[model samples]
Target chain A: MPYAIEVTDVKKTFSGKQEVRALDGVSFNVEEGTVFGLLGPNGSGKTTAVRILTTILNADSGSALVLGHDVAKQADLVRSLIGLAGQYAAVDENLTGRENLTMVGRLNHLPKSYVAGRAKELLEQFDLADSGNRTLKTYSGGMRRRLDLAAALVARPTVLFLDEPTTGLDPQSRNDMWEVIESLVGEGTTVLLTTQYLEEADRLANTLSVLDHGRVIAEGTPAQLKSDLGATVLEVGLHDNDDVARTASVLNAIGPHAPNISGRVVEVTVDNGPVDAMEALRSLDQAGITPTTFTLREPSLDDAFLALTGHRTEDGDGEDGSAAKGSGGAGDRAGQPESATVPVGGNR
Target chain B: MTTTISIPTVTGAPLATGVGARVRWAISDTLTVTKRNLIAITRIPEALFFSTVQPIMFVLLFRYVFGGAIHPGHGINYVNYLMPGIFVQTVAFGAIQTSIGLAEDLQKGLIERFRALPMARSAVLAGRTTADLCRNVMVVIVMTGVGFLVGYRPTTGVLPYLAGTGLILLFAYALSWGFALIGLSAPNSETAQVMSFPLLFPLTFASSAFVPLADMPSWLRGFATYQPVSVVVTACRSLMLGGPTSHWVVQAVAWTVGLLIVLPPFAVWRYRTRT
Candidate 1:
């Protein structure tokens, strides 16, 4: 099998007071021993896709397969091949750390002798060996998450699904989770990760599908997506808010794409960094718009995502604003600093 | 904390084929899940403590406070009459734990994790009901001890007493299936408790669990006389005290058997279709 997981035009509509199209003809394939990220904001169908692929949910139309087994028809066969660590830590709070892992191991029907030793190994590996005897209620949030991940690994599933694994964790815990996921990839495990974090996808995913409102907006390698945004993100912070339009128009002539103006800041992705920086400064000066700050930097995934989706990843669906709108009127002040932090990498 | 340990790829769950193998696999998975619940109860000693303590409180409240005013008829001692009623009420109430536990699991996303595993789908429901059944047994035994402590005696021999206990446990087990369905449907554990309590309150209170059918208003008497809980309580009373072998035993068995047949299939289906 070339692909460890295959989802083909899967669609699901959740019927309630208002029908939600959780997955709208979504499709993606995950190759063996590589991380495939489904990047989306909340309610963007990242979790819905994971649930269908894990056999916890059935797609209303179309199909999904895990290691060549149909997720709907051959559900048990597919289930045996994949492990899922969901957004919530699913470990029993009343059970000890070791107990939770052992219970999952037994449910997976591993041999009794193997389960005990495997649970011990996993507890130690996840840095919970000393606290293995303590109930999960006594464990910290990060500890619980680590144990949840360890429980998912109990049966050593070939394909793993992590739905927003590091979502609410502290930075240290998130980094630790990243290392664990990286090591799993090193050991030849295929991972399908759903994350809202742009940096996580940029650092981990070999290839990613950027989803917005149940549709794949863009799909590519991080570098490919970044380059597609252009070689440079030219951010010019004007001294006067009145000069926003002039700064954007001047930069428009410098780059192929239009500048995204937020408050006094005008940002545009350009084909060349140093040359564009020099041209932007000279043209802005000619236009009588003296920039308070001029930053010429390589485009990060954040810029790529913004360019593709017309909105930031962290913006909730209801709060989502189009790129053309940028920041206007009363919302401009708050959105100024927010947009300034977007190009966090290669700022010079 | 950033220690990198090698992950060894081990074999996955063994697939069960054929009816016999499937049944075995399901039974094993059920036991495993049941053990997890049981261990949880043991870890939180307050759960077992409160479970036993609640029934004892009910026994004392009825025996001392309500016992003086109420009469169950036939020259029977109030304690004996209340003992059988209390057992029925306790187990019926005990079954609510099924709904609460399952709802907690659902809210916590443990049910999603279980569903994703290769384990049998029925195991989660079966295991939950089974654990609740175990809890009902312990509560019954403790209530029996409290019954004896309060000067209640079973006139019939050990065999009939055992039969009465078996009948009560079976009825509660059947009810657990109904509660399991509620748990799966409820949005959270608190809602599950809220949903099951109203459904159970009338069944236990309106029936002959505490007061005799004749004591109730004329309209309620009809329901109080023949409802499953009243039938079971009456049957238990007859078994514990050597009475005219009325058809209450047959009726109670029939009601419980009917519930066992109907409710489990619904609960299993709910478990399967829930997302």
Candidate 2:
């Protein structure tokens, strides 16, 4: 089946006194009816890429196709087939929830009856029935975000682009949004989401692309990216900070690969599993280095991102030594060992 | 109060056929926005109180305080002469609200939502301008009622009175396009207010609104005489106070037509650039 979204060598340069290249020949494809994720840190060109795909911003070069329509040439048709919830909540505060949805439906050229009926259905579906008559200003942050999402889906778009939909929300609200997103994809709505939350991407996206600067550094299923790092990650917390280097050398003798020291904790990836874990512990015992804690488990997406990007996911800065972290899960463990590290964060 | 009960029912089914469907959709959407504005005005008593009461206060101050010193010996009562100019002034003042409204809408990201929709781009502006024109009509009615209570009467016949009122409404509507352009282009509400003041204050004061332009110094008079506000005020006064109406009436109509041609496109261009 043809992909729902295809971006080929797309480049966008925002021109001013100082020109910023927002997208540098970025390319990717999202299969139809799949939850695709553009995973990156802040200012990693995720929003710019979504803007280009939505046909809101014209690319300086390259091409993007959505739902078999060229984004540049057939922008209107592309827009009609997709729903977009921008980074910020864009609902009109002066309007009631019902009015906001109806207005968007009317703008989409739906029949007035269909607009009203669809608005009613959406209001109930989004748990906004009781507050449908209230002006949006009176709504809580979560309600407004939900209403914004409902307005985007009023046209029943086949492709939905959500840019950081859950940012700044409380934990409960974020979970609620995740549920709504899951149900949307359950009904076969193809979704492309950009987020800073590693868990959000790991929970929602079937296929994830780790974007840095303006290019895709790694792409695979969550488990595939993680297991590709090896069988298990032995994370050992040290009792003394001075024991980290000594512990690393001891684990290296058993595991072949050197252990990575993060503060008081030492971590090593090994394929031999518990046998390797026993051998490393015996070596440490013989060296008289008593550790604080030790755990051997499957690697996480954070580990995969660190192995690929050489940086943690949670680290705000994408420069040297900041491996993106958080969202530890093991789902599909397939490996693609092509290590190419581009510039961490360009203007785009 | 008569309490009449009617069953609530939904009307107007959505139809998917027609090339002009988006235009109709835009008109309806615009009406919804207008209704929301009206509801907001009603809910906030201060908005209605100020809109209705402010012009009446201006009429009272000018007719009682400045009436004697600035009288032109054109055989017309100063209040009668001032009534028409007040109508233009109130309507022009009323147009500023559109700018403030647009600026607020932009700040709230409502305009961005409209842009992303499949609706016609021109429809948003068209709907807003139409709603504002209706608001101008309401202000004209209220000001006309207050003018009568203050001993100001239109000496001209009903046709000329209607024509003059129409002229004021058209001029105000056209002026609103310029204000809407400012609202769309300005970076924020404070900048929009600052940007609007230079044009707004000069246009109101330099014209024949509060005083006769002939009484001004030669250079000032030359500038004030051809001002669009002056042409509109002169024509409206001619029709209301029974004067030679031929020349000023033509000038007022020409100014209105010219503005209608110029400002809408300029507003659209500015909107396109900003978005």
Return the top candidate by DockQ: 1
TM-score of each: 0.91, 0.82
lDDT of 2 by residue, B133-158 (tens): 88788889988989999898788899
Q: lDDT tens digits, residues B24-127, model 1?
A: 77999999999999988888889888988888999999999999999988989899999999999999998889999999998788988999998988899999
Each candidate: RMSD to true structure?
6.9, 8.2
Writing each residue's lDDT as its tens digit, candidate 1 over A95-120 gives: 99998998999888777888999999
lDDT of 2 by residue, A1-348 (tens): 789999888886655443445567788889999999887766556877887777766787898999878988876667677888865788877678998898788777666787899899999999999999999889999999999999999888889999888987999999999999999999999999998765787789988787765668867765555445677889889989889999999888875556788999999888788899899889989999998898997766567567666655554343111111111111121353434633222211
DockQ of every candidate: 0.49, 0.24
Estimate the overall C-alpha local distance difference test score of candidate 1: 0.84
lDDT of 1 at B260: 95
Clash pairs (backbone) in predicted model 1: none
Candidate 2: fnat, from 0 to 1?
A: 0.35
Candidate with the greatest TM-score versus the true structure: 1
lDDT of 2 at A69: 85
